[model samples]
Target: MMIGSSNKRLMSDINVTPFVDVMLVLLIIFMVTAPMMVQGVNVSLPETTAQPLPSEKEHLIVTIDQKGQVHISNYPVAMESLRHKLSKILEGRSDREVYLRADKKIPYGNVVKVMAEIKAAGVEKLGMVTVPIDETPADR
Candidate 1:
C-alpha cells in the first residue's frame, strides 16, 4: 500500500473588493437623496429680475405660505406673535438681516403685514426671496 500527500497552503490575503463596492454604493445613495433632505418651509416664490443675494453669512428665514401661515425656519408661528418670536430668535445678534419667502399666491396685504411685523422686531435689513427670471439675449 502506498500513501500520497499533496502540500498546498490556504489563501491568507483579505479580499477588500466587497468593502470598496459597499462604500461606493453608499456614497451614490447619499448623493442621490441629499438634496431631498434639506429641511425648510415650502413656498412658491415669485419670479423677479433682481439678482441673487450673496451668501456671506447665515441669516434667519421667515416663510409665509399661501394660506397666510407664518413659519420661522421649520417651526410654525402665529402671525400675531411673529414679531415677538423673531425678536427672540434674533436676540443679541448683531446682523439684523432676515430673509422673507412667501408664496406667489399670497396676497400683497398679507406680505405687507408680515413685513411690518419683521420691522417691528428690529430687523434692520429685509431681503425678499424671489426666483430669478430667465431672460434670453433677445429679451434683453
Candidate 2:
C-alpha cells in the first residue's frame, strides 16, 4: 500500500489587522485622556480670559507667600539672590519662561517685587498665576 501526498500552501503573510486595531485603540485612549491631562501646579486659577498660557515646558516657579516670603521653586531665596538664581536657571534655557504664583492675599507690592526680580534676571515675559473667583458653593 502507498500513501498519496497532497500539496497544501503554508500561509507566509503577516496579519496587520491586530496592529491597526491596537493603534486605533491607542488613539482613542489618548483623545479621551488628553483633556484630563493637566500639566502644571494645581492652583485654583484666577479667571479672566487673558488668553491661555503656554503649555508646560521648562519653567521657573516663583512664589511670594502672603507674608511677603519669597520662594524660588519652593526654596526660600533671599531677595538679593533671586536674580542670580533665576539667571542660573535660565543659563542654558534662553527661551525658558518664568511663571509667578503668588497667594491671593499677598500684597501687590510683594507681587511686583517678584516680577521685578524676574525682570532683573533678564526674562522679559513673566506669567502670573491666580485663582478664579467661583460663584458656586461647591467651588467655594
Candidate 3:
C-alpha cells in the first residue's frame, strides 16, 4: 500500500471483457434478426396514368435505367442476353407475371425494346411500376 511502490503500478492492459460481451450480444441479435429483413431490388420507377397494381405473393422485377442498362432482380444483363434470360425465366413458370421498372429518363425506344423482349417471352401480363408525381408545395 506504499504511495509509489512498484506493486501499486496502474493497470496498463485495456479491459476488453465488457467490449467482447457487448460484441457477442450484438452478433447474436443480428443473427436472430437478419432473416427477418425483406430484400428488394432498387429502381427508379416512371410515372403512369394507370391504376395502382395489386400486390402479389411472388413476382419478377426487371429494371431499365436511363442509360439503357437492363437489370433483372438487380443482376445486370446485356441487351444480347436479355431475350434468352427472359425466355428462360418465363419458361419455368408458365403463368408467372413480371413487373417492369423503367426509369423516366430512359428513351422510349429502349423501353419498347425491353417490352418487345418480354412479349417474345410470351409473358401475357406485364405491369409497369411508376411513382406518382407529387404536386408543387403551392398546389398542395
Candidate 4:
C-alpha cells in the first residue's frame, strides 16, 4: 500500500448570488408599492370626457377639498394667501403651469375663485385634473 499527501486549500471566493437575489426582491417590492404609497390631499375628482394634457415636465398641483379648503402640494394654504404662496412656489420655474384637483362636490363659484387666484399668481397655464369617464354601457 502507498500513502501520498496532497496540499488542498479551502475556497476563498465569496458567494454573492444570495445577496443579489435579496436586493432584487426588495427592489421589486418597492416598485410594486411605490404608486400606492404616494400621499396626497384627498379629493373626489369630477369625471370628464376631455383629452389628456401633454405632460413633458412636472407641474405644481393645487388641490381643493370638498369643504372648499385649498392645498398646495399637500400643504394647506388659506384662501387669502393662495396667490402669494403660489407665486412664491412658482418662482424661477419657466413652465409656469399649475394643475387643479378639486372635489366634485365643491361649488362652481369656489372653483372659479380659486382659478382666479391661481391666475393672479402668474401661472401662465392652468390645467384641471379630472377622472376619465367610463364608456361601458350597462345591461338592462
Give the Cα lDDT of each candidate: 0.87, 0.75, 0.78, 0.89
> Model 1: number of clashes?
0
| TM-scores vs. true structure, each candidate | 0.68, 0.57, 0.63, 0.67
Report the C-alpha lDDT of model 2 over 1-140, residue by residue, as the tens digit: 55796768998999999999999999999999997664333333345445545585766788776666777776778988999998998888868678888777666787787798899998978888754444343562
> Which should have the higher lDDT, number 3 or number 4?
4
RMSD versus native structure for model 1: 5.7
**What does candidate 3 score on TM?**
0.63
lDDT of 1 by residue, 1-140 (tens): 44786667998999999999999999999999998777677677887999986787777999998788999886889988999989988897888999999999999999999999999999999999888778443432
The TM-score of predicted model 1 comes to: 0.68
Kindly report which residue stretches of model 2 are placed more than 4 angstroms away from their true locations once superposed: 1-54, 135-140
How far is each candidate from the true structure, as Cα RMSD in Å?
A: 5.7, 7.1, 8.7, 5.3
TM-score rank order = 1, 4, 3, 2
Model 4 TM-score (2 dp): 0.67
Pairwise TM-score winner, candidates 3 and 4: 4
Between candidates 1 and 2, the lDDT winner: 1
- Model 3, 1-140: lDDT tens per residue? 56766666788999999999999999999999897664444445665466765665677888897677888887889988887898898888857688888887888888999988987777788888776566333432
